[model samples]
Target: MISKYQQLRAQALPHNRATLMALLKKHGIQSLSVFYSGSGSTGDTDKITATPPEAVARLADVTVSLHQAKVEVLAGVAAHALIAEKKPALEALREFTLAWVEQTHCCWANRDGGSGDVTFNVAQDTCRLKHTEYYTGSLHHEYSL
Candidate 1:
């Protein structure tokens, strides 16, 4: 049976890929890599680390660096949405990586803690998803009183 995450992944994966491809094409970014890490009991801190650090810095403001360019998701909204959202910053690149990890690796990838990197080779039209799950353990002890 398909679960909610499966259903969402089925619908979201293609769209997310398409969106990312379009953005890359628009900016002439032949290849890109997005690094994501999430760790928390309830998946509280999840984020996409700027590959070169300057990639996103450049995206934030075109004037910051000539190599870095900004891609506006919506006219009035934040410009970083192309790479990350505002509230949780998990939309474009973030969503693509984290969502895939959660769907394929572990639905609790973030909740239980995991980290990975996704590399996109546009010219080859391929993407690599690599991740490692952290150790999660609990002790159950009971005594009759």
Candidate 2:
């Protein structure tokens, strides 16, 4: 299982790589990976075979995990400015998590299969998937693990 910190970092790639780098740098989050979870045209078919080699070529502390169902990272979100301004740690985490999810749509990559009923829980600091719009929730539940 990938750490929540790393997953969030990779997902943020679409929004701002520099922001992610800075965030990770401040907190010392070194491990990272990008994962994809989706079904194929047929029930038994598989689409993705390899991770996007180019995705993390230039990014440090990041890797790509393709054709997988779930990814998790253990990380705290914090505002770069707040850190620079010397704000409280908890305050920065709260603001950063909300902004990260709202600004960056990590689940957007799985659009063809629907947002997959994706939900980001700031309180729990976890991303949840109840189901995919294209398939049943059971499949998602299995993939989620």
- Most accurate candidate by TM-score: 1
lDDT, each prediction: 0.56, 0.34
- For each candidate in turn, the TM-score is 0.57, 0.21
lDDT of 1 by residue, 1-145 (tens): 8754356455657666666655555555566777766667434224444344444444442211011113455767644212222322133565567666766766554556777788777777777888878877999999997
| Residue 7 miss distance in model 2 (angstroms) | 25
Model 2 CA deviation exceeding 4 Å by range = 1-15, 40-145
Return the clash pairs for model 1, or none: none
Provide the clash count, candidate 1: 0
Q: To one decimal, what is the Cα RMSD in angstroms of model 1 from the true structure? A: 9.8
CA lDDT, candidate 2, residue 118: 27
lDDT of 2 by residue, 43-109 (tens): 1111111123332233344332211113333476442211123333323333333334333444432
Candidate 1 global TM-score: 0.57
